[model samples]
Target chain A: MKKIIQFIVLAFVLLPGVARAQEAAGSINDMWSFPVVYAYDEEVTWFFDLSTTTFAAESDVYLWIWSPSEPDAGNWENSSEFAKLTYEGDMIWSFTLTPTEYFNMTPEDIAASAGFWFRLKDLTGSLQSEVHSMAYTDYSSFAGSGELWRSYPSSPLIDEGVSILFNANLAEGFEDATSIHFHSGLNFWDIAVEYQSWIPEVVEKTQLKNMGGGIYKMDLIPQEYYEAPDGYVMENIAFLFVKDDWAGTTADQVLYAGEFIPPPPPVFTFFPQQISKKDFLGIIRTNNEPGINTLIYTVTAGTVEVTGEITGGVSEIKGFVNLVSALQNVDVTEIHVLVKDNTDRTISDTTIPLKQLD
Target chain B: MRSKIIYGLAIMGLIAVGCNDPDDGSYVDPVTIYEKMDGDWGLMSLNMVDEYAKANAIEPSEQNMGAYFNYEDFKIRFSVDDNMEPTTYEVMGDVPPLFPANGYWKLSSAFQQPNGEAVKIYLYSDAQKTQMTDELKLVAVPGSGEQMELQLVRKSGGIAFVSYSFKLNAVN
Candidate 1:
């Protein structure tokens, strides 16, 4: 019995060592974090693209990080269920954790450490991926940038997390405020997340995290925070920093969404190098603005008047008007053309001289 | 003997002249524009040009509309009688009716115009080809590659405004 007990103890100690010795299937193709930047105390998800690795799709993946402090230190051979990553499909896995809470270390310690260093492994700790480190965005320099407001990513997408840092010291009427809140909207208030002081949830959701010395940060995924409808195109976020239930508010601020490139201006024109009264006149407009699909045209020649509409999408709207029939017997020297888009915006109003056909 | 040698040289010269004759013993009838444009033609591309934009030197004076409005399946068949006279023209596909879909058609000239004037294809709604419906210009005659370009121009007063250029390939 004594020998058996000693053998069992030896097996328990050697089993982990053997499991740790198992080779990783392959290295992960890539890894990144949403928000791209986050504070140590904030919750962030580390995504691992395991497509290049031999890891099975949607397989159970667990974190085995060490630097910035390891939370699951003794749970390598049998990782805790909490350490298991959530499979995000396409051979990708994500582990969402607040660095401070996961490591049981202060934000300062996490910052001072060598960042997020880890390898991903299976439950048995046999199949693993190569070691990787998640880099931290050091926003410590923002304190001296002297800007009133700065977004972690200068331009932010609607669905991703964005950290908006505000320097209350730069704004007036924000001094001695108990709390700061974000009152914002997308596309110049086309959609809004109003800071309703009466609603407890709204009050809590809009409150900003005071970073001390009049520096505050508001971290939010714009889509989730605003509950924007499907297919909502976010242009620029119009916002203001409100202090303590609108006791005092800073001036209006705007942060343009990332990749919200404005479409090119619409171009309208008549077709053919030269025209005669006995030809079909073409009307065309390309690079039409959104909601400006149809172009209505009115042509005036002598005493005769003709009107028609050319319809298309954002790319172009083109159609031919039967001028061969419209002006068959009409004698004229020039024709006046007026073109307007579906939005009632006039695109062109001009006169074209006739090229007398011999 | 000298007389005989001169006669032999004259016979050889005649043979050489006969061999060097420029004309081959073959005759090919001239292919008219109607015959080249006959049969089915599939749309290779369709472009809309803005004449006002071009005249003013504006950007994006033309747009390729080949991919729009089921134009990829767009086909036009210009039929001719045994005498090679244009009989009836019909456009295939459920695309926009840029012109009359089917009609009796006749070309302004059976051959390409040589006076720098565009040859027009007159479309008529009546069987007798008297009631005119639309007209399209034969901008490009079918070449060795079985490709042709037809343009429909829109005009007001006497000035050309917009045009649609249809590049087509002969379908086997």
Candidate 2:
């Protein structure tokens, strides 16, 4: 009886240890909190969801904050050693730590500390989630050397094929900048103004031209990048400028592409291609779109031009021109109708052969 | 015995401090002006008659007076939260086909009614909200707190470009 009892006790202890040592199936799903890009003074409480797989009591989890120097290393600062995550409701583990607390630096040190990253790991430190980078920006740090402003294309609308003369004054530290990259994304305005997390596609970086003093300029022809079909209006195009470690992304500039649209052809009916001198020539016509300021109707009978203006938007406009006097001496005449808009765009249709009526 | 009594009181004080709940029962949701204007607002009808038309000796007709102003087959909706981006615009009309109405809207705190009776809301055509497409005066309908009207005015250099009076009925 004593031997059987010892075997049962040993089995209970060994089985649990083997099961706990086994690798867990799933990983951490998501880590979230308010104010992703934290200010120096703000205290952030991050809640990590571990609902995917529950571990045995013997198993453990950890958090690692990657330092700026150790870019390639998996294990950097073991945040779990200092701050242990307390159990929160709904299988979420909570840890309260500030940027200043983690880095041992205050908000005033953000200019030197640009790139920072963090991640969560298991006890063995083998299983982990993707690293989350921190993008720290402060008004003072952003305008470190001096303030910058953009001139030209004051409004967001720009004509296609025309080079936008983009001119700006660089800050003090940015004078040594070698290149400026252009980054763009569609529908940036639709992203939440406060927590805009969408990443923009970076276009190729090019060297900047120093145009005397502290002024810099770039003549960017948009058509080269955006293939806007004829009469097409591209919308929600967000663009920004970035330089090498000198300046952060400048304020976003959103623009609309306004290409020229040609006017549509006018529709009209001038029946009876052949007309008689005594018969009145009735010309009727209309345009698909409005804005017809004036319409001129003309008839030519070999070196003789007779014309009259027709006004208004009508599907059927019947007007009779008395060629009885003009064609009285002629045998035949050709009829023409011209339509025009306020912008000086014109379209016309012609009818031929007006034999003198017996 | 006296030292033990004093130690007991000190431990009890620490316990009381630790037991205090950070979240009090008193929590009120704030009702901001933007929340009131957030929803799907259908445009039933629109008319934009320019002051220049009257000066140009033009007749006051829908066709002649505002010939350039075309507001047909279009619907606009405002989002409630901070994610109210112009890209998420629910444009219900032919406007998006030709002139993409990636509408964005925001309330201008700078301009308010002198009497403080109304708020000014700025509307934009693109997602960036950089271009000022229209300016609207949002006011609650008389006697109806839930119902409202948006009066939009387009002007330039003291000349009336277009005046749009919209009766927005909430669909959502």
Candidate 3:
């Protein structure tokens, strides 16, 4: 009779017509609730909606935004550039920009759509830009150099920040009626981006006896390529995507995907788990778990046990280095370790150099 | 094509007239100012040296410079405006000398104070040096035409050359 009741309940819960009962749990995963709405991965760090990042010599787009809040204010004026920074998103940009002078601001918190108003300049020499609002785009790790097991000497230091760009179209492309939405949950909200523009230089020419008017080319390093300023380390930051005109598209269609790096192995910390003093041997073992490391002790008078393992892997290495007679009566010092890669390549061999600190 | 000169005459003041030194006054030649400034006027004349000298903080020497020189494709000029009148000179045919990035200069004139002291004022453009006021004058030429040496009494001096970029923009 009890089994019959259970079978009936199971069948009812699995029925296609029956609605699945969602559990009213107290906690909801942040990722599950707040999600990335849209993105375009073909660009560097700039994500857009009415911005100066859209500047190009031949491209018919030239307008910049300086609204720190109110993403839709689209206030395109050239005076009183004070209220021009955005601090809603957890980011900052500091540098000198055009027409306007400095790009300096420190952000203390994050909020929805910046409350700043922007003045749009007509660089296209065409129509005026009537931008409604802009959403920030996030870039993940911009694949740089780093080490795992060994702390490499920081001869040259490292740091990080991002450049966000946008396109100011000859005409506003995305609208509320057909508003383009981005899905990158990691997108920038408050931006401090100060885009640059190009000016025309007048050149003169003289007729050379044998040479024609020659061509001159100059090589310059873009500011974006500059190493981060001193004293900071960026975590694998990189380009996320663009949405210069992503509108009315499905969440998947607007998404700009980022490549994820598998998390590094957890570092296993060792505590001298146990030590047994036998007549001729000193046995020692530490908690041998994921990402854990180990070393061997020097029994000035006896033999000792030592082991090393691959982090997050099943490879186990157990061995012993014989302490010779020359070491007899030698104080049994502490153990040290050397971590190796799968190919037996030694990565870290730090001698946790010990001392008798009574 | 019609010749065009981008003459940049930044003269700041009108100078007083009459030479207190009666001997020097009679010898003063009015035609020389206009004659020396002409070379096809702008393509290669006095304006170039004046512009370059003012910008570079060095006056033109007779042989070493203030001579016809080649530049980013075209030719250049040289000149010294009078101290008695506020004059705006004509432009040359080629590209005029840009105020070099080093110092600055402007055109000015001659003067004689109530005291009988003959004072010839020339504009000084170097920010590193004190701005020569209406009281200072162009030092009399050490020598004359062909060997003519133009030096500033307290206002200007030195040989103008392309690489003579001393007294760079102080703000820089």
Candidate 4:
């Protein structure tokens, strides 16, 4: 029979890639009426995730697209469009066009006339609901995947060169001038607030119940990227803290919350650094996730440190004590830390002047 | 011989339709599974506590903002058939709040383990119950055990709720 339907579509195109990355979603519960299309002002608002599509006169839903279009090739049903709005029963059966008013009512001389589609509708009675799929705006919440943040406030404690300000929320990120650099193992830097670093020198975009959200990088202050270990409270929660979601995500899905408490030991940072060379030889790794076999270090000059190690044997934290041999000479001044984590649990801190930066 | 006596009466009607037995021996009568689970889980949930945050707060809550997402196309149809059991929730969205309209709630899901595995799944609340004057609290699974999980609170005018957490995935 057609070679058994081409061997079941060639075994689903030869399977594996984790089931083609399973998840285009289905059954998002229902009751949505979204309809906002301002498109820089063609005007039309209408949103409703809180209720309005209990659709019982024909049910099916869609109209999900956040930009990019042209896919279904041979233009059937307007060839895969996005930006549509229609319903049945209990109202809004259809009307709110505005892709410049539905392509000026008949393909108004075609030239990208706004669209975002999702409409199947088919109810009329018995209630039967089930049609969902939207909310994938090209992924990238730090590269797709969710929920893994857990809170950890052991009674407000994180020592070492104190300046500890990392209150979360950096919604819908990335704007060509990106920022958020804090890593471990190989030390790193970059987190300022009044001195603007996660690049929020000013960016504002608002729209709530309409989705496609964003808030852009806010409040980073990892003591401008690592060098802590003296009594560990780093300038108490540094200011300008607004990008509240990079790790724990909660712009209020009923106030979810979690993810932030990492910088609490013989500190260090990693990753984010696109340019910084007045003097850089970075890599100061310290992981005390619950290790405290007691380790210490000291350093301070105009900033140049190398050779530090705690290499992580199954990593509950192990060794690392070189601020480049505690900063060569007398011009070196401040950098001191003392850890002891295999339950010995000691803790110390210090760090603020690489010639007083930020 | 007469078609083997009608195939021996169709193999005794397929052995009485395969003898029906899913763990046989049962005495089910926990008041009909606690009245069909607190009576349909009190019309799905959320109705009170108004405020109570510091008993050493681990995540204790109650701040509903107008429980949106239910417009049964906006209906009131009540001349008096919600059995009049509201104790305090007032907004009158075209008028329909009196008696617990948003003030108190008390859920009770009886437990009974022995490997039957049930952590408070009782449900049934076509909205009407008594025996609670105040002090409202009822975590359920007979009272918190069976890997406990079910929390809902909010009554004193936090609007009513717009979005709380049952999280069916915003982007799993």
Using DockQ as the yardstick, the better of models 1 and 3 is 1
- 2 against 4, candidate with superior TM-score: 2
Residue range A95-192, candidate 4, lDDT tens digits: 34344443343333223433343433222212222433322111123222233111122122222111111222333343321333222211212222
DockQ, candidate no. 3 = 0.00
Better of 1 and 4 by lDDT: 1
User: Candidate 2, A15: how far from true, in Å?
Assistant: 99
Docking quality of model 2: it rates as incorrect
What is candidate 4's CAPRI-style docking category based on DockQ? incorrect
In terms of docking quality, how is candidate 1 classified? incorrect
Off by over 4 Å in 3: A1-264, A269-272, A276-358, B1-172
TM-score-superior candidate, 3 or 4 = 4
Residues B118-159, candidate 2: write the lDDT tens digits. Answer: 777676776667886656677543223445676654444554
| lDDT (Cα, tens digit) per residue for candidate 1, span A1-358 | 9999999999999997666577667888887786566778888888889999888998898989899888888988899998899999988899898889999999988888888889999897888888888877888888789899999688988887788999998888888899999999999998888899999999999999887888898888888888987557789899999999789998899999989877788766676546666555668788766667888889999899999888898787888766766787789978898988887888889898777653
Where's the lowest-lDDT run of ten residues in candidate 1 chain A? A272-281
TM-scores of the models, in the order given? 0.62, 0.24, 0.15, 0.18
Specify the highest-TM-score model's number.
Answer: 1
* lDDT of the candidates, in the order given: 0.84, 0.50, 0.27, 0.30
Q: For residues B1-172, could you state the per-residue lDDT of candidate 3 as single tens digits?
A: 2232222221212222332334544455444332332221111122212333445554331112123223222322333345422332222323223222123233342222445543343333443335542222222221133222122221123322212111101010
Clashes per candidate, residues 3 or more apart or on different chains: 13, 1, 56, 93
TM-score for the A-chain in each candidate structure:
0.67, 0.27, 0.19, 0.21
Ranking by TM-score: 1, 2, 4, 3
| lDDT, model 3, position A44 | 18
Better of 1 and 3 by TM-score: 1
Each model's Cα RMSD: 8.3, 35.8, 36.8, 32.9
